[model samples]
Target chain A: MENDGMQNGNENGRESAQSLAASPLEVHDLTVSYNRRPVLWDIDFTVPEGKLIAVVGPNGAGKSTLIKAAMGLIPSASGYVRFFGRDLSESRQRVAYVPQRTTVDWDFPTDALDVVLMGRYGRLRLFQRPRRADVEAAHQALQKVGMEQFANRQISQLSGGQQQRVFLARALAQDAELYLMDEPFAGVDAATEAAIVELLRQMRASGKTVIVVHHDLQTVQDYFDWVLLLNMRLIAFGPMETTFTNELLQKTYGGRLSLLTEVADLMRHEQRKERDPL
Target chain B: MSESQLLDFFLLRQYNIRVVVLGTVLLGIGSAAIGCFAFLRKRSLVGDAVAHAALPGVAVAFMLTGTKNPAVFLVGAAIAGWLSMVAMDAIVRRSKIREDAAIGIVLSVFFGLGILLLTRIQKSGAADQAGLDKFLFGQAASLVTADVMVFGAVSLGLVVGLALLHKEFKTISFNSDFAHSIGLPVRGLELAMTTMLVLAVVVGIQAVGVVLMAAMLITPAAAARYWTDRLTVMILLASIFGAIAGYSGALVSYLAPRMPTGPWIVTAGTLIFLISLLAAPRRGMVARGLRNRRNSRKTLEENILKTLYQLGEEQGGMFNLRTASDVARRRRIPESQALRGLGLLRRSGFVEQANNGWKLTQEGETQGRRVTRLHRLWEVYLTEQVSIAPDHVHDDAESIEHVLTPELELQLEALLNRPTSDPHQRAIPYH
Candidate 1:
């Protein structure tokens, strides 16, 4: 029995190694537009498995749009996201996404445990409620985030950090191999930031890939192992130590300031013309 | 009246009572079920629009068919109501007009057209059209067995559909983006919810007129919110309230010969709303006021204890009650409460009577200095990091000090760079 267990472990390790060699998340020549105006130019990148990656860019640099496009939440002009060597639709069960904290209504009449149980809805039948096993998994997820005491509390009563922890708990209950979180650290307290970083580290340690859209350049080194620098186009994609530098940051954020400013001005001008009809 | 006389009056001549009871029950259940989702989505007025929009359809149906068949008129009304809702949505989406404005526009235009049609039909020499006009205000006492069956079937269908699609409806209402991301058909779910709303309104029009339907949709849900923070409980409570109002309205209209059922139903709904508003446990207005008053009294008592402790800390482990009173004056606490508060402090061992004056006990001094430290720390944090004006910082700090947990105080300390003095350069007392 011991030998068989060892063999099983060995096979799992080899399978993971082969999967990592062929990137788990691959975006190929992706281009997106809003109303026929380019937002993201042709972009291509691949995120290897079991790594904590950060996608960092300036505001309006398509940081959020990139994640939304990849998740198939929004229509893309031309591109596709492959998950585990398949399209996103085919392998959606193996993926989990945590949207921005502000996107959900806090005043909704649900407790912390109820929201976490939503993660199991994809696995359960449409008309069914969460089973005992699903409930246990939700409880375990809450415990992992140190929010077990708040499971029965109304979501409206939670502080900002507690709310973010609940979102994380929901994602944890999904038990997916790949996680995509959009700005988990934004507006959170320092303790929550540390806790979330630690959670992501644990996910990476468990041989699961986690991609986070992050702000705050100073904490990038402390949080993420891999980095994808974007400025509406693929600026660079590699290990943080190799690709994250002043030159790349300048190219991604600094040099395009005037061009972005011009585009925004033109958009405003077009909007005014449409409104006035003169 | 004699027993036999009363029996005859109730048993045989009390057909109106039966109609009222049955009609109210169905109307209440149906409206409350649909109202729960409408309230949740913050589209409480959509029911109002659809109800009013049905009026013209009812009149038009009568004018075309030349009959008072409730089913035919109701079907016509439902089609009209649904079309108006669709038009309103399209206008809001295509144009820059806000949803509220679009609802107002659609409601008034469609309803005005309905009134015009009713007036024209009445003038066209059809005596049966007189009864059709009663639908505008509702005549619940006139409901027959057929009407009850229609309402019961429709209400049952809505409730069952809601039960089957409960999870999907909740997901879509609470978080549309998340629903879409998870491959839930968001548009289909929304359309299903809207269809249920239209059906509820169509069933309710015979009992409550279009003008009063909004009250039925909004009141029960608003009342239910005061009782529980769970969706299932809220929906159940709302349905019960709705049913009570519906039944009462029907009963009143039956007992009184000429009274309209819609207004009576609305009156019952309003009464339930008033009870929930004042009597609910957590979110009720009266409960919140009581909690606020209790918290204020506690804050005052904590302040008095801290002031006495501060006096003891300054005067080397002992101070007279006069000195504590003077410190309270500096903190702007009223002298009368301060005295009464000092007496309570003495009972609690925070202070003791000695030589015709009060002095802090060991425990009292520890707590006083801690409050003082919290106040000074908050003052420093506000003026240094938050960049509040020095004068503005003191008032905020004074209020915040009482609520600051040790964990939060530490975060404030780190955020303010661990300053030893306030912006005024006064030394901050520390434990």
Candidate 2:
């Protein structure tokens, strides 16, 4: 705690550090820019432990950038991220990330079991290979996601849902205290979505924090206990019942977003008619 | 050449030939091994640019050292090759120009400069520079023991580095974002991959030259991809392919007098690729064509069977004989197509010719019933579960019925509650 306070440098930041030390993740004055344009502006929040949280926003709203910037995968224009009030580098082992499914080439020459084996690589020393114990642990992780039978199956041959499950299995093998998943539910089948939700619940029961970049607005209340409404800025952040109100949702997705959706839909309709000559 | 000459060439009996062959073989093994990483990284053309860039360095190194030393060539080539890689990446990152254009620009500019320097050096009449042009197409026959040692050590170092860092390499190549999040030095690992690629190209440009060095990097790796789906196995197979091409090319040059070994090496690699493209199992063009033919044949035969079964049902009998034209009319296909299908079924003992017409055997009746049953099940599922219009279900179910497996059939049955009739009021047979 003393080290965390000193790193914060100012009395105000030190006060917040001491208060946020009990939380799993805290972001203070976070702003992320891409190509000299700020994608996320002045984001600030501290998340509690053992809660399933969702970050929801419209297209081009910097949802993924927040997660990447917080994990130090992308440089932030301003502000910093802390896990348990410590720098990300100091507590990286306690945090895990599942990137969007499209970020990787699924057609890579590897199998499900081998992809899962990557989860254990962080614990291995430099130039060391995965051992028998690591292999056994990887198997257990796959079994937890109901993918033990497809362990030897090549990744490209797996269906969309199965590929998502393999990704989840890889994250499960990390065995971390806090998980950051980017759109894990996108393009997955009903069964895979259900399995992921069940796994998230189990993780919550064990006092592990899970933050998801959720896309489906219809199931936000049903899937997560906490909601962080964002659209290039923090609109609201609190318990799902209190913060997930229509006013905040409207504030996040108001005006330009709805008009944009309408124009896109109109263009799609016109294109379909043009294709069929109707 | 006679058989003994061939044997003598392969057995390494000739000292000069042995040195050249060892150098080329090691060149192949090293380039192809590291080439797998480059292939997966989609940086195959970077090798070409690097190799082309090395020529200028070789000409400069000779001018500075005033020697034809192989060690100096390697140092010069490696530096220039590494520089080309840096330049290509910097242009791609800092400008609007695409990677392909950057590679093209770097490759041609560097190669053009090398040729300019080479002409200038030749005009000066440096007697030791007589064979400097061999670096363009390579002089495999002129490899001395020192040259062989230099090439062999560098090539082997590339292979050893690949083996030692395979894990980190795989993680970074497959998913660098995830690797970065997990605390792996992704930027450093990328530099390592790039360095190995440059080293492989620079070491190989001596034997394969700048023009054909990319083949050593791309051909064996492409052929290996069709043979396996595992990275380690692909690397192993690619190295073996490269080694075969290496020695075979050297042997061809030895026997054919005046033929260049580098081109022959690439030719041997292309031959292997052609064989893999046509003959490898599962992914090969020939195998896919064969499977497609078998599938269409099965589909035609089953459709004919179903036609016969339906005609029998109209007549209230299972084994009534029907003419080929009658079968064709019922199925709305040509008579010849129906006859061919019946002929194929007769060969398989599913049908018999008797009384100037064809009749199904007992086994054929059971098979026909199953196809009909699958069609009806799919129709029912489409209409009852999917809520599609009843009339639209037949065309959709027709194609799907042929490919549905027994497990899917059982699931469809369970999902649809084992209905006795489809949406069109056709009975779904159960066995």
> Which is the leading candidate under TM-score?
2
Model 2, runs deviating above 4 Å: A1-16, A256-278, B256-258
Number of the top candidate by DockQ?
Answer: 2
- Tens digits of per-residue lDDT for model 2, B277-396: 999888899999999999999999999888888887778778988899999999899999999999999999888999699999998998889999999999999888889999898898
**lDDT of model 1 at position B248:** 75
Per-prediction TM-score: 0.87, 0.92
In terms of lDDT, which candidate is strongest?
2
Cα lDDT over the full model 1: 0.81
How does residue B115 of candidate 1 score in lDDT? 88
DockQ of model 1 vs. true complex: 0.49
Query: Candidate 2 chain B — worst ten consecutive residues by lDDT sum?
Result: B252-261
